[model samples]
Target: MRWSAGWHGSAGSDRRPAGGRTVPGLREVWTCGWPEARVRAVGDGPVALAVIGECGADDAQLRDALPVVRAEGWRALTRWPGSYLVIARSGETLAVIGDLAGQHPVYYRTDAAGTWWSTAASALAALDGAPVDVTALAAHLAFGQPDVLAERSLFRDVQRVPGGHLLLVGPGGVAVEPYEPAAYAPVGLREQAPVVRAALAEAVAARIDDRPVSADLAGLDSTTLACLAAQRGPVAAVTFADERLRDDDLAFAARTAATVPGLAHHPVPGAPGTVYYAGLDDLPGLPLTDAPNAYVVTASIKRAVLDTVAGNTPGPGVHFTGAAGDAVLSAPSSYLADLLRERRHRRAWQHALGHARLRHTSSFAVLSRARPASRVDLAGAWWQTAAELRRPVRDWIPQAQRPLAWTPLLASADWMTPDVRGLLADAVDEAAGALSDAPARLSDWSDRQDLARVGANTSGWRALALAGHGIELAAPFLDNEVIRACLAVPADERGAPGQYKPLLDAAFTGTGVLPGFVLARSTKGGFNALAYAGLRDNAPVLRELLGPSSHLAALGLVTEQPVADALARAAAGQPTAQGALHLVVAAEVWLRQLAAAPATWWEEVSGRVAAA
Candidate 1:
């Protein structure tokens, strides 16, 4: 019975199917067997709200805004990394809201009985909604698809409220509208750092309330958060390392921990985070997530976090690490492009040189990339749709928060043999169109790309869900306030290749949370060596996972044999695209899950839920 709930009249209990029924006050009867949810009732009036996850502005923060909600008739409490639900009741009206970045997703539908909503997709879909969304499944499996695909959900009948939007579920039925991400007016460069420092500190401070906590120190987000956490009191800091990977994650953590007086840095010996095949055969829930690497790392990462927290830190501690630091902080290569657009040549060139130096690449490469229409890549064009500036697309982008490119992510379609690719011939095109339709800027496509990062939905909510069970984990960098602050600073100030996220560097160094040397240090570690070896070790599992009747191929989204050949080549020591391969492995695993789901709970629900 691992869950978090605060209900009066003892309506609070485990989420297991065997638990008690009805919360007395809630509109819909919740019937499911998931323990990873938090339900808390707050405020006294006809208006009420209850969230099912540990993400939201702190209780006091929400309480302070009550006056405003009453005056305005509606309010969404928090924005950054806050997956919150604000349900307001006035007369027969019910307003349900989700966070700005889809972290705490809210979905709902209306019928003769009024409207119902929740964070869990299937929970609501089971009650009433459309059948499986195959195109969404294909788009999801398409690597590099926009991480946050507007309001579309796995169930066509179940629509989600956008991150910056609100859903009014009332006697009048459902109506959706946008609210947050209020226009950001950039400040002068001199004012940037101080604002960043204040916002970063506030975000970090909000998460450090009294619970014993552990922080990460490998990258800028982790190091800064951990350092700031230390300023308040003693906190355990951690990073992972092993001989196989060149990334000196542990060494970096150790050095920084030594500099900060109250910080305790623990170097956790690395385990094979998991080869693409780690869960090759696993398919957990129905209408599985569209998030990238979700099947690949979600459970393993959760296991690692829980294990680390349980093993060393005393009495259930919350784990905090950098999650959306790159997306939130790194300006797209487009900032320089925007400068070029404005004809600010001198400043653009200066930033370009600095960025080129950071990547250890050429200024030409930076210039070419920065210019949105610089290259017309034919191989991967998801759409011929010109961006807002009518520039051409960027080419193949292999990993997290990359600016939108023309091609489907490399591994997005690679898993299927040619036959399967043809079967789902429009897969890549549909995916590209879907992503392109979302409003984005050339200067911050990567920021929009945050929707798909591994840290976005699955990982954060998993941790939030676990919070109810006394295993609290936090990523202060993902705080809404931190996101707002970063948005205020010009993207160019921090988006250069070598100087990516300089604001973070300057924030800590300026505040003395980290040394000047740390701020000046350019390179961060990479772990390709470890990933390759892990992939090799897990070859057998992968081979079995991709046998003749793969669900992906059966669904006409992938062909089986090419994947088999790829596994063999990877095993034979040929050049491997590790990033793309991970997507293939994970997507296949999800297809397996979707295939297997019907036999279990989904089978019962899928049949009843009709198509749109």
Candidate 2:
């Protein structure tokens, strides 16, 4: 719920005119939920800079970055370790820089008076009471990709600045400028491992300070973080163990805790209520996230873990999650397409065989799918996907088995109505027409898009943790430096089969930080059983939520009868539209909460209101 907003014009000018002489100055911006200590400002009056969030920069660095950013643009201020937002004012020009990841997104709206910007799109939308943009929401639900319509926010008239970009507002006008490239120059995994290790260590170190640090020890990424944090001091490592899950995560967690010193293992046993969709009955209690967050469906389990950490730590604490580890550390099998594009046929076949073995399919099937992707550029792929969306819905296929594309349409795309599908297809076509500077390789573009998706959702999870438990959630894997270090390595090697998170293994092995057992572990646990159980138990509530009166259905996005049928199939333990339903339900919940949201994000001063 933390946000900050400012403007480059005199819409809300605080200065009174002396003798009918209007002062030409920028209005004072407003903020909420930001502590004074976390807020850092340098310079004064017209030319100044301010940073809000968990920034690792001091006054010296801020003073250094201000002039550099003015001369070099927004990229100069992005070298810091932690995630943060930078607002710089150089004379009449102002720049707002968001992180490489969408964890800290920037949204703005421009008009005759001036341009207004904020960290929260909803806040900007509230200035004009903008309604939901159906096409954007349709694209979000159907594609599940972040950059499809990168500039469109969920609320109409509130424009979003894409990740790795900055919003520059000056006397001339407002413009969105890219500060970073979609992909970095290729580096071998071996050469990049040490750099990644250093970046990750710094990212983790940035979060560790006076606060009590706790981490999730359920998988390799979180385990690495827990071990790293343990080096600093004691860390409360939590593993949510539910008998219904029947996973080996708890066993591995216990072994790691026993071996790794300074890690006090606290296993939180899951109750029947600790399942996905467990808390949907009380919609008002949920935090109003700025976008549709998948974590809303599984907040019960997250809350359970947070409650355990809260019980152990007496005061405010920092929780580390391995949110974007898979996105950054490992590439998808889509890297096989990148291999085929490079004419590395032998390597492509070998990797395809490995992936086929993992999926229990023929290698030819994997190669055939990747071959088509190799032949098509990003725009062509989007065009083909738009054509498919315009046609009838296809049968449900597991997302992992889908063919590699620029943006693979998920099973959720099948859940929308025909009209909505057409709208989404048109939007996709428009986005394809606008795709001029896409990354040359599929893996490069897809990797950044994947990171953006995970980063955005993790921001929602951070908000949930903060609002519900007074805790700060940190994801070191999504830091700008860590992303640059890891993604610079070629995707094929980073996602090379036969090794799990090869980048992490190479970085931490022989370093004596993460244990050999953890680095060697290949199998990761699944929460399918818990998800199904939650769906079965909460059928009535879901039926009511996605029924005819649902907000999503009211918007003509989801068909009411089909959603009800899907819920019935889910409750009966059949192959159903669980993923799609989660998106629909989450969007529905978000819409409901948005209607009830208060306009407390801004405060009116001296009867002068800032127009959004």
Candidate 3:
């Protein structure tokens, strides 16, 4: 909730450490529930502490841990869980650290005098005095992630700290030390499975017992958690009852919860209207074009579910969700590449095909298609794919040197193989160099390391932001133990025959945590088509907000002729799942939000467009 930006004049121009001299140009502020947040600065060069809100148990633990942290000579130690920004200076060094999970944004830069940092990226842009880059905007408009992170954001000189990392800026140069996950060693699949399963059950049990918490019981992940928790005590299992979200397995949620004696199953129906408008008032300035609306939709669902539960409760409440369940627990083909190395051949083909789809989806698709087969064409495609892979680099770079750099060092780091062991030797060396002054090894192959590296880099930032409203994300499959064990199992055994998540199913067989039908069901639901139907039903709102001259028509976000043809085909009872409708609805909702608040363009537009 707190937002502020400024600069303290240069006090020194020294490069090397002058034994405990105070550094200059650092600022931080916090604004919400963290009432105990305090800042004490006396005989120092440049040091500031700003606390935003009331500290919960987790934050209190961090706060109590800080004196010990400062005693260790650490310029900054931020252990709080809520949104925050901490910038401090000791000598010529300026240390800036946001929440490890990236819920809060802190932008920084270093130059001739010293370093300057702020909570908002745009604030840095305005301070540095640069124009917003339009090419980056075009790329954002075309693909969700930028074509290459080498391109700075529209607001010049501004850069986002990659989630789960800290920034150290000094006269020498700027360095980033990425947080690492703690590694759990390998064991045989059979030997590891039970332990992993038991740990997950334990985690779930502890969470359910924490308070009168309600867990989102979607068909897959949380339902498993609910089944396990229900055996111990009463916990609320919640789900949306919209026909679009109902999927064929909505009944499975009820059936599974019913198996747990005395558990309450709460099903909230998806409300009518665009569903976008209902949530638009809360999130103003969401980009109208070139981004998905999933954030708003999920936020709306979370708000409604929690509000209903709060209405029946007496005080502050805790809610649980399965947001990271899919990413953490379920192995997406891309994230699990190292574990399933045997499928390397098929994976090669899939990656090739995926690359082709991306190529064809872009504006250059037509040009590429018109060209005949040749080595040059093949090489062009390869370079383009590689470029696309490095699109997130800009977010990693600091405020200075953003536009001047052609090499995308940060993006390259992100696309490094998920398994740290497989990282190229040079990259490993570079990472080690960055973490040399850090407290511990940065390249370890552990769960904590993975959580800090892979999880934060990929979905950790997204998850942290969503957890703000007393909601917790549960991912059984992503359980660190389960993943480590799954990784240890040989490829043939893990993927034996026709099963995905083979080892996982075996581990949970006797756990009594999932119904048979739900366990056996492989195909999941897609509420996108339903989302589209809802948006189409509220076409009047779309017209009103978008001025009937919406880019959905102009830029061919949706093709006019194809729309008419598809509708005709659908009316003839043709089986049209039309998943694009979901994307459109999300986009429309975002557009409406932007229409409401046009000033906060970068905050809303940047993320929606940059998301993977």
Candidate 4:
């Protein structure tokens, strides 16, 4: 990688620079000591392309991926997983894009002369000419982080490329287009499930080769992949040790790997990392805008784990992950359905009920022992009371005057379907012709879409951490062909054989590398208990970071005393709604980071204005 402009590039090889200093028009490129072939790029004309981080996938795997990049040129291809950014020079134009899902945060800005560029957005504000967006600060105070909406960034002009999107900066102006999730006709469940399984097996085998590979070693996804690969070659599996945050995963990984013949299992310490939870770029004594929590700390923790794993071993091997498999293959509609069905939790249900004013009576109340009349009151909280309590004035004119909005996210699938499908009756059928476009209920369609994206998104985040170590991580389940085939499968077959990722499991069922129980296990490990415990253990930091801020109290929607009392109760082992709220507070720390950044940085990034 080349460093152009005024950017100074340094990593472990260079001494640390003093804090709070700023650089202007500097470009630096750093990569972990992965093979040079691992970071190859090709483009001509006005292109300045960089393919850094962990993208090499063995010779055969490279053969599969290279054709896509070569054919599409610099456009974002759908199948690439892990933490990555592709900056391409097409003709006289420049475009930098991240993977379909945000595995890592990408920050960029157009210069004063309007030439666009991207760098790690995390600390870009520390650079010269970056602007700050205070309204993003307010939104961060309200929503915890700023990327909840598409094209909005903490710094005004710096924007995030939405998942399944490409950002093109050309003389014609900036154009963002969705990649990976091409529209395809839906197919029947039985036929599609097997196809997904076959495509994924092929993708995994192509990348892993005959060498040993690594798996995260948990339930469903990783275990299944390890088993499949074992049929073709020896494999290694790793998991976090029995620490506060990784206790359940350690046991699950060990147990699963035990069944894989000739597979080695490595359990490394997985502790909460210690870093700038709110902003890694913040200088000492400069307050952060959001809470810095254990997850950020995980970055360092992951690096240490991988380093130890590599030192114990000899050469590099493909690392397999279940990443984003949930988003790409599983249904999130269950959570939404649970809210609608469990009529007793009105406040909780408000968060899941479809947009206010569209509530409908369903059989869920009868299914859950709550009466229909009681459920009606639950609707009031989500529909009328909650909105009025949160804000009297609508943020904008009511939806009645707005273009009907549509997103393919399926909140709940258990209940409500045909009713919801009516909302998107006029949507384009891109996923048609090749597959069965059966007029399924809207709920089923939503569930399918969620499953398709979650796996890629989740794996992408893990891949980001691996990138720091320069390890190429791949998720066979995230292969576009696998996803497209899964899309062809019927809903029942999608979750068949009593397994959540049945198609994925079935793809490896004959491999004989995984234990029968590992493949058949239905229960998922719950990580929330440990995470909440950690939060309670660190209550002092939480209070110090959030208590002084009047952002929540000023809204008047929530009483300050109750919020404070709840935190106290949680710290004393009494977990409540307040504990979950703290997660939001932790995210707020990052928002504050963006809000307080230099104004010039914000202006060069997201193209927004703010209050002083």
Q: Each prediction's Cα lDDT score? A: 0.55, 0.85, 0.42, 0.44
Tens digits of lDDT, candidate 3, 254-303: 88777766458877776664243344433442323212434544455445
Please give, for residues 359-472, the per-residue lDDT of candidate 4 as tens digits.
Answer: 243334322322222233222212332232233222222222222111311111111123222211211121121223222232243443344234323443344444444455
In order of appearance, the predictions have TM-scores of 0.79, 0.95, 0.57, 0.61
Which should have the higher lDDT, number 2 or number 3? 2
lDDT of 2 at 465: 97
Candidate 2 backbone collisions, by pair: none
Deviation of model 4 at 437, angstroms:
18
Instruction: Give stretches of model 3 more than 4 Å off.
Output: 1-106, 109-133, 137-154, 163-165, 171-173, 181-212, 225-234, 243-248, 274-293, 297-307, 333-382, 386-497, 500-523, 543-612
Candidate that scores best on TM-score: 2
**Residue 213 miss distance in model 1 (angstroms):** 1.1
TM-score of 3: 0.57
Clashes of each: 17, 0, 26, 61
What is candidate 2's TM-score against the reference?
0.95
Summing lDDT over every window of 10 consecutive residues in candidate 4, give the lowest-scoring window.
408-417
